[model samples]
Target: MKTMKMIAIPAAVLALAGCATTPGPDELRTNAIAMMKASFKERGQAKLDRIDQDDMQRLCSEYVGEKVMPKEIAQSLEKAQQALIKYPADGKLLGDWKLGERIAQSGVGKQYSDDPKKPAGGNCYACHQLTKEEVSYGTIGPSLYNFAKVRGYGEQIQRYAYGKVYNSQAFSACSSMPRFGHAGILTEEQLRHVVALLMSPDSPVNK
Candidate 1:
C-alpha cells in the first residue's frame, strides 16, 4: 500500500504540471510556424517568405477541420476577393482553345527547380478532370467534361469562367484553386486561353 501510494502521488503531480504548462492556441500556432520555418530551407525561387500567411490564409487555417468560419465572415472574404478580379479591358473572355489545352497539360513551372522566366501551366488535370479522353486524373474537384455543353456557351458563363480562373476565392471562399490572375501566376492572355478551354464548343472539354 505504501509503495503504490507514493507512485500515485508523483503521477498525479506530473499530470497537474502538464496541464499547467500546456500551450494555448496562440502559443501553439507560434511554435508550429517556428518549426515549419526551421525545416523549409530556401532554394532557388522558393524563398522562406512563402511560409508567410496573409490575412485570408491565416483565417482559413484557424477555421479548418470541422470549425467552419461563420457564413458572414466567409461572405465578406469572398466579396473582398471578388473586388480584386480584373476583367479583360477588351471585353474578350477567350483565346485559342488549342493553346489552352497545351497550358492545361503542361505542369512545368513554379516549382523550386523550374525556370521563373518560363510560362507557368494551369495543370488543371492535377485537380479537375477536364476531358473524357483522360483515363487518369485527380478527383479533388468536379469533372469539367462538357463544361460549356452543360452550362451553355454564353457570354455570361464565359465571363464567370474567366473570373473564376482568375480568382476562385471570389466565387468560393477559401477555395483550393490558385488565384491565377490575382496572384500573377497566369497572365491575362493565359487566363483567356483557359476560359476558351472550358467555354469553346470545339474544345474537348465541351465535346
Candidate 2:
C-alpha cells in the first residue's frame, strides 16, 4: 500500500507536467501561472503568487527529473546560494540546545491552517537522524548523530552547520533540505538554537 502511494504520486505529478503544453521557457511560465491561478483560490495568507518561482527555483525546475546539471552550472548555483546566507547580528553562533531540540523535532506551522504570526518548525528530524532516541527520523539526509563530535566542534563546523541550515543549496545544489533561514521560514534566534543542537557537546545529537 505504501509503495502504491509513492508510485501514484509520481504518476500524478507526471500527468500534471504533461498538461503543461507551453513550448518555450516564457510560455511555460505563463502557462504555469495560468494553471495556478485557475486551480487554486487565495485563502488566509496563501497568495496565488506563492506558486511563482525564484531564479534558482526556475533554473532547478528547468532540469526537473533529468540527469544532473553541468558542473559549472551547479557550482554557479551553489555560489549564488552561499552568498544569500545571513548570520546572526550579535556574532553568537550557539543558542539553547533544548530549544533547538524542540524546533528540530517539530513539524508544525506554514500550512494554510497555521497561524502566520507564530514561528515555524525546523522539522529537521523529518530528514535526518538527530539523536539516538529519535527512532522515527527519516533517512532522506545523512544521520546527524554525533555531528559535533565527528566533525569536531570548532569555528569552521559551527559556521558550516549554520550556513547549511540557512541555505542547504550552498553545500548541495540539489539537496532536498529546505533553505530554512534563507526562505525566512525561521528567524535568526531559531536558527541559532537549531545550530546549537547540531554543534553543542551538551546536545543529545553530540551524545
Candidate 3:
C-alpha cells in the first residue's frame, strides 16, 4: 500500500507540472510591473511614483509600432496636450538670447544629486544641432542652425516653435522630444528662452 501511494503522489506531481504553460498576458504584465517596483528605490526628490507608467506610456509600450492607433485617438491625445500649454500672460513669446544660450548649455537638475531649486536645462543640444559653432551637438532631432533663416521668422513659425517646445506631442503624437513645459521640467520663462535660441535672428542657431 505504501509503495502504491508513493508512485501515485509522483504521478500527480508530474501531471500538475505538465499542465503549466506560458504566463498569460496579464500575468506577464503583472510580473513586469513587480520587477520594476523591486528594481527602483526612492531617493531625494525622486519617488516610487515616478516609476509608475501613465495610461499613455502603457499604451505606447504595449502597441509601439506593432499597430497604428486610430486617427481619432491620436488627434485626441495631441489636442489634450495642446490645451495644457501655459502661455505667458504678457503674450510675449521671446526672451534674451544670451540668457537662453546659458540655459541650453546647462544640463543640470532633476537627478538625485541635483538641486531642485536650480533651473534645469532643455538639453536640446543633446538631441539636436542648434548652432553651427557647436560641433558637438547631437543628431536625435533635426538641425536648427539657420532655423529662422530657413523657416522664416514669421508669426506662424514663432507660434509653432513655441508650441513644439511647450508640448512636443501637440505636433507629433509620440515624439521622442521631452514635453519641456508640459512635463514641468522647464518653466514658461525658460521655454521662451529656448524658443529664442532657435528663432532669434541674432541667436547662434540662426547664424
Candidate 4:
C-alpha cells in the first residue's frame, strides 16, 4: 500500500505540472488564427484574406482581450497608420452637408448582401451622436453633436475630420472605429460628405 501511494503521488504531481504549462504567445496566436480561418467561409466581397491580419492588426489582436497595449507600441502603430492617410488632391475638404447627413445615417455597405455598385455609407450614427434629433445613437464612439461649433469651423479642423473618417487608426491605434478609406469602404466623395457632415457650420451636427 505504501509503495502504491508513492507512485500515485508522483503521477499526480506530473499531471499538475503538465496542466500548469501555458502555451507561448506565438503558439496561442497561431492556434487562434488557424481556428478562425477554419471556421469562416468566404462569401461575396468577404474573402478569406479578410481574416488575415496585417502587422498592425496582428499586434492589436495579440493585445486584445488580454491587456492594454504598451504606450510605445500604440504610438508606433498610430504613426504607421497616420503615414498611410491620403488627402484630397484638390485641397477641398468640405462637401454638401445634406448629402453627408444621408451617408452618415446609412448603415449599408461592405456586407455580402450589399450591392457593390452602390456607394457605401459612413454609418457615423452607428458609433456617434451626430445630430440632436437622433434619439438612437451608439455610444461606442464620442458624440459629434455641435462638433464644428466646439472644435471650431476651420480648414485645419475640416482636414482633421476628413483624415479621421478616412482612417481612425491614424489618430488612435487599435481604435474600434473602422478605417473607411484605408479599407476602401467609402469613396473619396463619400468621405468628403462625411467630413462635411461633421465640420459644416450649417449642418445639423453643428446645430
- Which digits, one per residue and each the tens of the lDDT, describe model 1 over residues 14-72? 99998898788899999999999999998888889878988888888889788988999
lDDT, candidates in the order shown: 0.91, 0.91, 0.83, 0.89
Residue-level lDDT for 180 in candidate 1:
89
Off by over 4 Å in 3: 1-19
lDDT of 3 by residue, 82-194 (tens): 88777788888899787788877777878888998988888878888878778787888888789899999987898888899988988777778988888888888888888
Instruction: TM-score for candidate 2, please give it.
Output: 0.84
What's each prediction's clash count? 0, 0, 0, 0
Better of 2 and 4 by TM-score: 4
How large is the C-alpha RMSD of every model relative to the true structure? 2.3, 10.7, 3.5, 2.6
Most accurate candidate by TM-score: 1
lDDT: the better of candidates 2 and 3 = 2
Ranking 2 against 4 by lDDT, winner: 2
lDDT of 2 by residue, 1-207 (tens): 999999999999999999987598778778878987899998876777778878888788777665668889989999999999998888799999999999998898777788999999999999999999989989999999999999999999999999999999999887789999988888999999999999999999999
Instruction: Give the candidate order by descending TM-score.
Output: 1, 4, 3, 2
Q: Which stretches of candidate 1 lie over 4 Å from their true place?
A: 1-20
**Model 4 / residue 59 / CA error / Å:** 1.7
lDDT of 1: 0.91
Clashes of 4: 0
The positional error of residue 75 in candidate 4, measured at the CA in angstroms, is: 2.5
Q: What is candidate 4's lDDT per residue for 1-207, written digit by digit as tens? A: 999999999999999998997999898878988999999988887788888788888788878775989999999889999888899999988888999999999999778888888898888888899899999889999998999999899888988898898899989999999999999988898888889888887899988
TM-score, cand. 1: 0.92
Clashes of 3: 0
Error of 2 at 197 (Å): 0.2
Better of 2 and 3 by TM-score: 3
